[model samples]
Target: MGMIDQLLVIWGEPAAGNRQVIGHLARSAGEFRFWYEDDLAKAQARGFQMLPEFPVHRRADDPYIGRYLFALFAERIPAPTRRDSAEMMTAWGVDHPDDQFKVLARSGGIRATDRLELAEYRAVDDDLSRPLEFRIAGRRHITDAAPLAVEDAVSLRREPDNTADPAAVIVDRMGRKAGYVPRQYTQLLGGLVERGVPLQGKVVRELLLPDDVGKLVVRIVSSRL
Candidate 1:
């Protein structure tokens, strides 16, 4: 039976423009990372404020935000140790990473249309530093969540009928591109299931795409519902 699937992106700012919103999703595609600061900065400079979406933790003390950021970056790359995240944080100048962020900012990656000011970074080390491990916020367990619904999957694959913008269409077709917030995907999957959708065995995956678009895929695995 062709299930009535509905896919929804589980991360990022909803008002995140064409590239940020997650609707009925498809496969839980894996994860990927690319330079996004430019797009984000331009949007912020242009006055595009990140729209407080449904599930993004609102509290300033929310560890999920950090966890999610790390998870999004760490997944598939390799498991980073505590020392790794901390060391990378230290080398990147958690307090002044904007130096690097500016590189993305000038590249027109951050949406100049939005007024989203992201934290910038500076390199403290002389050699190219790479993130060796990844840790999710909230210590989110990756094995606990169900996959996207069958209906959501189908919708994400097909083009949206309402929007005429090709970029929007491309982003939507890309599935959920925003970096996932570690254990946050479970919350996202649960949120959709709670909405009366039948998503019992879905997992979030990643999709391959071009340079400008953030790529992510949501797959419906049969085992870990």
Candidate 2:
């Protein structure tokens, strides 16, 4: 509801199968803390591996803490010294491109070389008056789709049967399946839906990239807010 303080380190791609929540990276008491989720063993069985920089022995009870962002995530953000860094900063709505946490949250920390991605984690009890923006996930799997334009209205449908994520919220454009909402927001938005809160979504922007890997950003608003 205020400033985002945590992000879910997601592993794997939903389209490929067995997408899992690896862990959580949070800002606590003026320092950064990171820990693997309790069910890491289950994820490991499904092809998930502990990051080389973060060994599995480090449990949730005793997490890794540091004054700055962990190298595992810090490397994902583009360097502020890059020639196009300013352009990238503007694209991600980051006022200070060097602020690694903000950059990571806004950019999704996605890379083609790996299946790992970061998703802003929001508490279900947090205020919803402020509109939340997230990039539609699984867009690479959407086929035979018309291009989405900015300001286009979208629809959200709960997918209780979804194996990857039971709380998954499917984003639809004109009755066609576009993609699912990022995993991080599912619990919060899903909880709102369960309480019969009216939620609306609209396309705020779209980025058409190479290899048909287009991304769409949708802004969600709740009537209760």
Give per-candidate clash totals: 60, 0
lDDT of 2 by residue, 1-225 (tens): 357788888897435554678898999789998998877876776777778878855656899899988988988888768999898778776777666777887777877667787777777775567778888878666576545778899877788998756888888888887788877778887777777778788987664332336677798888665
- Candidate closest to the true structure, highest lDDT: 2
TM-score against native, each model: 0.20, 0.84
Predictions in order: lDDT: 0.26, 0.77
Name the runs in model 1 displaced over 4 angstroms: 1-45, 48-156, 164-225
Off by over 4 Å in 2: 13-17, 140-147, 160-166, 207-212
* CA RMSD, predictions in order: 18.8, 2.8
Per-residue CA lDDT of model 1 for 36-56, tens digit only, reads 222345434534454443233
